[model samples]
Target: MNFGTLYRKSAFTDNPKGGNPAGVWVGETLPSGDVMQRIAAEVGYSETAFMAPTTGYYRTVRYYSPEMEVTFCGHATIAAGIVLGETEGDGKYQLTTAAGEVSVIVQNEGGVREAALTSVEPKYTGASDVLINEVLSALGWQPSDLDGSIPPARAYAGAWHLVLAVNDQNRLAKLNYDFERLKTIMLREGLTTLQLVWRESADVFHSRNPFPVGGVVEDPATGAAAAALGGYLREAELITVPATILIRQGEAMGRPSRLTVEIPATGGIVVKGTAVPIETE
Candidate 1:
């Protein structure tokens, strides 16, 4: 089947150099899983989106890293939405992803086209002591490196993420870990990424995402993880519900990104970011 224009987008930032890169592919029918995997590997992005005809006006979307399929990915959604908005015209695009249905609003304003996606219902649960130990061991991080304020927990909106908070920014900046061991733990835990974070203030946070399970070293702008973290914080009463917070990621990798998470007084948490296309060869 013929495919729409494939684009690379830097999610969570207006500049090309400041966010995570994602590959967006739109088509009538998805390519073989193997082909999609190969393309994702070649792209070498943390996540690549494959969109195809579902039933009706909705599209079937799948996410892949270099190595495997993921239940969800937020950065890739924004990228794909921008591609669709440019080609199909801007408004709301309905997607049927593995995580479930999500709505994306795309708009071109002041000659800059951007997209925002609302996550599925967010949920979380506290991590067991044994699981926490296993996670810390996998990353080769000692208990002292963790902040007790935000106890370890598993959060999910579109994907599963292990949320951990570090007290120091220096700790956040120095992100060296055992990739092989972390990958094993993440796969065992059914985690898409470990959302390592440092709270800057009541409304701001600095984050680092280790995504070895997805065959990537790090994620610059992790929108799905941010949404999950927000939900977990609210649900746990760690943070006030119905608040809006900003998450900054990828600065440690020099890509610096910003993600705005709005925790509604009611239903699903909204993850907001902007995506612009990168040039073709």
Candidate 2:
């Protein structure tokens, strides 16, 4: 049972201790879903990326958490990009995922390696009043606690997330919720995570993702949610077109991460970040 050459990389930050760690496995053939799930559980990260080459610069990729498989994952993708760049040389890699096709470009600038991933066609849908109310109750937040400017919606950029913006940064910092109850709600709604955010400026925001459905309490840095947010903001006419935004996450967790989101006039959102190898003894 040869798994592959596994690399441990931290995404969205150069400092190994300050980013989300992901396991990247690049191999000749991917293992069965059950084996992959078990391997991910053993890795014990938020997500692990499994990649197998399909053709030139094209690969089949799958994502899995400790508990189950996910359609897509942003941080893990970034980690894989860095690994591919270091091992296979910097270039563009086309990824075929369960949700859609994604492309990741790996580059080295001034000795710093970075990767940019363009998500699948992003979109959003209105959140039902019932669902919103239930989520709010689970989070112990009132309607007034929400930012009226950004209405509730279910946003998707490969994976689905419930976007809920707050007016206060303090409110975003103090995150505590019913784990089992929220997990149940998220599973029932087919949600990957809750994109909880607080806007600091027109192009800067603070984000926290509750990934109960993924069997994690919180995600330090979430690229999928950030891409979804960029699309939702534009589709909802909250932000101007052809804009770029900065997402600061994982701060509260002490593993700070930064994700750069570029929103074009019309297309999939592009997420840029840097990943570094996590050397362990």
Candidate 3:
């Protein structure tokens, strides 16, 4: 199948170089799963989004990494939203993924397109001490590096993420881990990413995501993980409802990105950010 109109966009930042780059393909019909996986590998981004119009404002969307297909991907969704807004005008779009239905709202703010996506019903589960210890061992971190304020938990928005909070920002900044070891454990535990974070303030936080399962060393901006973190905070009673928190990420990797997470009193979390086209050489 001939894939059409491939776009490269950076999510979570207005600047092309400041966020995670994702490949977006808007085709009349989506290709086979194998073909989609091949195209994603050829594009060589963290994940690529394929969209085919269904009826009205609904589209069938699938996310693929270089290695395999993911159930849901937040950054790619944001990038696809920007692309849709640029082509079809700013509006709300309903997308169907393997996980479930998602709603994305896109707006053109002074020529810069920004998008917000309402996640599926979020939930959390306690992380066993053994699992947490294994993950920490893979990361070369000691138990004392953790922040006691927020206990370890596995959070899910669209995908499952292991939430680990560090007391020091420096520990979060320096992310070097045994990729194979981490990947083995994560695959066994059915985890998508390790959401390592540090609190800068009540409403500000810094995060790093290890995504070996997707064949990436780290993700600059992870919207799905951000949503999961928000759910964890709310479910654990760590934050007040009707709050908006800012997450600063990718600075350690030099691709600085920002994601805003909005938590209501009840319901799904909203993750919002801007996306810009990446200039190719």
Candidate 4:
């Protein structure tokens, strides 16, 4: 059972029970893919982050779900950042991931310590009609259920997500989907999660992410999806530039998580949140 320095932390919330729980393993050297996958599965979290020191202020990090290795994971990154800050010191750290280079800034604000991760260059593309129809069908939704303001698209920051905005918040709340069918379509399309959301205002939104592909029902706080949404809005010209928006998630699942997203005029998107250590026996 000995792997390395394993820490359990919840990301995107200061309370241990509010945010998404992620396993963070810090070691002198990264473990094999199979070992990492096993450890992640044993941890039984949505995603577990394995990181090892490489050089000054740089770490080699990889993410794994219970099912497979993920290209990148934002909440786990946030958890790892807090772990590093608590173990080392509060500062900036560069992470080398399969997706690309990501930088995290850890700081103490007021009485709480928080981490903000700047995602890799983000991009988005229109989703094919066939893909949209299949996904909607799997969710038992019609094309009329979608918000005309923001069209469906695949957005990527470190990982790819299918973004679908609904005009009604009720639709986002009652999230019932066919897990096997949706997982098939998502895996076929190489998607990480479905970013089902409802925009409340210009700077406020509600989101729910189905992560059947990750062997989880849903994600309480999806930093990758939130970062992707910020990028998508900026790139799609749906939101004004240099805006900071608040995303409220996980309420439906009873684990409320808040994600703060900062969108600049250009470059990578920034997602900020605080993580608290989770004590397990």
Candidate 1 lowest-lDDT run of ten: 51-60
TM-score versus the correct structure, for each prediction:
0.94, 0.98, 0.98, 0.98
Instruction: Write one digit per residue (lDDT tens) for candidate 3, span 1-281.
Output: 56588999999998888999999998888999999999999999999999996235799999999998988999999999989888898899999998899999999778778999999989999999999999999999999999999999999999999999999988997888999999999999999999999999999999999999999999999999999999999989999998999999999989999999999888889999989999888
Off by over 4 Å in 4: 1-3
lDDT of 3 at 138: 99
Across 100-201, the per-residue lDDT of candidate 4 in tens digits comes to 999999999897889999999999999999999999999999899999999999999999999999989888888899999999999999999999999999
lDDT of 1 by residue, 1-281 (tens): 55554678878888888898999877678999898898899888899999986223478899999999998899898888877887788888888899999998888778878787888998999898888888787766788988888989999999999999988888878878889988898898899999999999999999999999888899999989998998898888888778999999998889989899899866678887788667657
Screening candidate 2 with a backbone cut-off below 3 angstroms (N, C-alpha, C), the clashing residue pairs are: none
Clashing pairs in 4: none
Shift of residue 265 alpha carbon in model 3, Å: 1.1
Report how far off residue 216 is in candidate 2 (Å).
Answer: 0.6
- Which prediction has more favorable lDDT, 1 or 3? 3
Which pairs clash in model 1? none
- Ten residues in sequence with the least summed lDDT for candidate 4: 51-60
**Candidate 4: RMSD to truth:** 1.3
Q: How high is the lDDT of residue 115 in model 1?
A: 80
Task: Candidate 1: list runs displaced more than 4 Å.
Answer: 1-4, 54-57, 109-111
Give all candidate RMSDs, comma-separated: 1.9, 1.1, 1.1, 1.3
